[model samples]
Target: MTSLNPRLGLFRDQHVVRLAAILALLLIFFAIVKPKNFFGLATWQSMAIQFPEFGLMALGVMLAMVIGGIDLSVVGIANMTAIGSALLMLQIAPVGSDASTGYLALAAAIGLSLVIGALAGALNGILVAKVRIPAILVTLGTFELFTGIAVIVSGGKPTSGLPPQYAEVMASRLFGVIPMPLIIFIIGAVLVGLLMYKSAFGTKLYMLGSNETAAQFSGLKTTSLIIRTYMISGVLASLAGLVMLANYNSAKADYGSTYTLLAVLIVVLGGVNPNGGSGRLSGVILAVVVLQVLSSLLNTFPNISNFYRPLIWGGVLLLVIVVNQWGKNNNLARLFRWKGNAS
Candidate 1:
């Protein structure tokens, strides 16, 4: 274990460096390929607006992965939350309503969405921690459960006709430059960083992930920890749903269906081990940026259909997993050699 620590530390640093390099290279490539399109503020702004939709989901997924679990229900939670919020907004302030009424409706919708997200997340936690169902199975079940509820509530139709102020405020830029979604993403990431790095809860989470048995024996409230972790994930998903609602000016049960896959890809690409107990939020943030850049670069070619995006994403995901696994093996070999030399 002692010998492995230094190797893991070095790998973590190298992973960040690799992601940074990839981002820089993608930027240069895009700039050269479509200087007129890529060099413009509009292009960058569009990227900023789009990435946060899945980027926030990736953050939630990262938290689950860090605790040695996976939350497949993030996209479902997001859709359900958005659908509920949209319905509430329509009820409170239909189109052509007063601005004051619209604002009030917006606040109420946000509050309700968050509360719904929390309850949904709590249900997953209860099933996993209390009932001892595997996290993956529990989340998978809830994904369908939540999606079904969203469909029933929405009647398989998009929830539209939200107050204009909702989009005007949410989609608006600060000082005519920075996007609201980008700002929200930054704030969310920073808060997650603080929670993961600056608090006792973070330490306990890591310890639990590293060795649940040890955590249990040491008197850590493992059940509570798991529940809290999933709750945070749920909140993140709800937040992402709100962002999507603003962007699309509507909500639907099947919106961003591919986002669950993309979120997992981002988390894994960010260096969070699927096996658990190790990863960095910083790496996850960089991974989100890297993916957004790659996605923008792909847009440079009109011939590449958006339908192929899943194929591309899946290929990259497999490649990253293989590379990460190979690196681990190589590091273990070196550690063994060092032990042999010392003996």
Candidate 2:
């Protein structure tokens, strides 16, 4: 019963409540402005299919943010993994292929990409943990290095010529409605949520983020833990790359360049502290839904230039940061408590 209360308290958390309210308001506003498009199956499908890539990236961001770190190299890691997978697929099946050969190639590509992702993560982890450099600096440097390698490997062109089975496996709808990418995203979310809440590692991570000095004094293996956390982020980023590869039928150096900002924004808006002591995967998942819906809404207006999106996202991020700081200064928790009492 006591445990249940603590869990219930999360539902009553100010951030969760606020996100729910904003999501509802956004839906209502869009529905009112574009009734037909907002309420359509196509819109919903687009939202479901598209958000997962960003969602996956944001989830990786959330992990780093949880540990009081950031991974700006996610975009580079994702592109590199996708390119590697493409190269593997081509090598496996060559020019023309049978279904059996293509499936073999797909399996090999997935395995290879995951390994590459882990290795990429290990590199970031070592620089940050072993070398004791600040995470932001380490990741930023690696981001450029990874991107340069990807560009050199692919010669600045998208890798296309994939086995037909690659697209077939990724594009097929699960249960005739849900996109496979969405399903993959949900699975990742669930695993991460459990990792953050139900695991001892989660507790240690929170402690480390809250106060690194204290964590080290308490005899926690801070370095290894940071390494493992970044490794997880890398794997998730690679998964995003694989999904993007399938979605577009190609892999490019510049793919999802805007994603890095959007991902950090998602993590921040999802209520992860920049100083990084507290956060929840549940909140991050809701944030994903909200952003996806908002993104799809932007697409509904044909006259709205796609270029406006980053600007809008940037503006929203700035607002959220300001509001977040204000809320902290103003004791917004007390305000919520007061409002709850009045209600």
Candidate 2 global Cα RMSD: 4.7
Q: Alpha carbon lDDT of residue 250, candidate 1?
A: 96
Cα lDDT, all candidates: 0.88, 0.87
Per-model clash counts, in order, read 0, 0
Task: Report the Cα lDDT for residue 228, model 1.
Answer: 86
Cα miss at 332, model 1 (Å)? 9.9
Q: What global local distance difference test value does model 1 have?
A: 0.88
Q: List, residue by residue over 1-343, the lDDT tens digit for candidate 2.
A: 1121124577767777889999999999999999999878878877778888888989988889877899999999999999999999999997778999999999999999889888999999999998989999999998898899899999999999999998888876887888888888889888887887788888888888888999999999999999999999999999999999989999999999999999999988988887766877777888889988888888888999999989989998999888888677567777888899999
Residue-level lDDT tens digits of model 1 in 266-296: 9989888887777778778889999888888
lDDT of 2 at 45: 79
Candidate 1, TM-score vs. the true structure?
0.93
The reply for model 2, stretches above 4 Å from the true place, is 1-8, 331-343
Give the TM-score of each candidate: 0.93, 0.93
